[model samples]
Target: MPQESSHRVVLMVDENSNPFEMSCAIEVFGLPRPELGRDLYDFRLCAAEPRTRMRDGFFTLSDVADLGAAEEADTLIVPNRPDTDAPRAPHVLDAVRRAHARGARLVGFCSGAFTLAEAGLLHGRPAACHWMWADSFRARFPGVRLDQDVLFVDDGDILTASGSASALDLSLHVVRRDHGAEIANHVSRRLVFAAHRDGGQRQFVERPVPHIRDESLAPVLTWAQERLGEPLTVADLAARARVSQATLHRRFRAQLGTTPLAWLTGERVNLARRFIERGEKRLDVVAARSGLGTAANLRARLRQETGLSPSAYRRRFGPSGGEPVTP
Candidate 1:
């Protein structure tokens, strides 16, 4: 069991702020993980005012820490209110600015981007917001590169999630980046959520009107997972689903916002990474078992995906790894 973390995460709750996003942040960062034998973050929630009404006046919050709590944060989840156009509290924006200037990592969930934009922290940077607010966000803050379709954007010091639920996605991604795939997976499993969905994947994919019965990929995905050690191909997956390769490809794109081959490659990469983190020393063995075929391919893929070679990854995440080096 590791010691409790020193990393502080401060969430800003303001008038009319959405509670759903707040719960998402708390679920991910606030809850202590007894399973891991320690808490992953030193989490706190702060409000600029002594009393505040939440979104649609669903509830009132009080007795939280003062806005000054953000000053001590290593990561600051910014204030988000329902009225995207309404100006944030001047003091709240100032606090955000201070946190940014101090180099604290900032996160904006949904309309929270408006707060960061108001604070001048997102200028000339990529951000993601709910699709409903995309047009307004772009028109008002053209300088901030708003990726209207992505689920989230991880821009090093600043991050943004497109919608309320996607806040969990961004939080899990942060865990993966800060800890590693293994810890992130454990957290996701605890939440009963998918471990990963690439930030670049479309958050809102439009579907054509259905002309035929819709089929699910769950069975086929499970089938493929059990056979990842075998040399798998799109054709093999298509055969398992009893569908044509074109249909398989179409379903993968429409449902997953990715090609079949891309999904398969990602799974293999994750498998290789898991093996290394479990203390596999021989890169060639890890590659073969993960179906990547060779150490050279493992090296190229691991570095491309994780920015770390097999040995470096193991040294940082394997059994003997006392603490993971910050990425």
Candidate 2:
């Protein structure tokens, strides 16, 4: 039997829902765990209607709770909805808004972000949704800060995940926040997944997606990543790739769909983030080592990208001591 608690989590499911996402939620919160020696979560599966049919033609009956349940839940989870481009139900949108208004944490996994955006809960908040639907999501919610380069975005009370595997990362992050690293690590071990994955959705973007291969920029990118701390320019990159700067730019635009400077900045930022996470606190040192030149430059760049100050980010992810030595 599950322990009764005032704090509850309501997972909203609907017809044609992706069973894998639903199962991800259940695997994280619904399963019984006596080893933890306490109630982990009060998880409930509720739907808009009483009977919901999955994608594979299986029907599962739900004790369907009304919109009122959203008002009472401490956390509201919107799992992957139908893959179609259809908008979320009006009632479901209202429920999500009401729950958010009542201080409940709202979570969206994969296409579930569409529902949150429709509810107006993601306005001005940084959100991560499936890369494939990023364009549509941005078009629909113009005010929301849609970041396609992260696995998950934990923006205070609201959380959004990129896609399927990212759901696990977000859930593990939640467990870490609520129960600390020890418990979160245990849960991760039980699931046979990494306790934490390095990098973000930037690492998962479809590289070489199109069959038309351009071997031109590939070696240049590999070389650039290897020497992130070294000062690099378009001329240098072009020279290394044995191509004109114009040709290099065209190849980057055609293959990576971004400018050379933008890609280099992204790589530098990624490196700085890794250093910060490893307890490196001296902003000046981090900036120089990551090729951003100065502490002020790093601060401006990091703030523009992640909305976090160097000190704040270091405090959150860096080592226990104040500043880490330059490595």
Q: Estimate each model's TM-score.
A: 0.94, 0.62
Clash counts for all predictions = 0, 0
User: Could you give candidate 1's per-residue lDDT for residues 167-220 as a string of tens digits?
Assistant: 999999998888778788888888999888888788876574567665778899
Task: Give all candidates' CA lDDT scores.
Answer: 0.88, 0.75
Q: Give the TM-score of candidate 1.
A: 0.94
Cα lDDT over the full model 1: 0.88
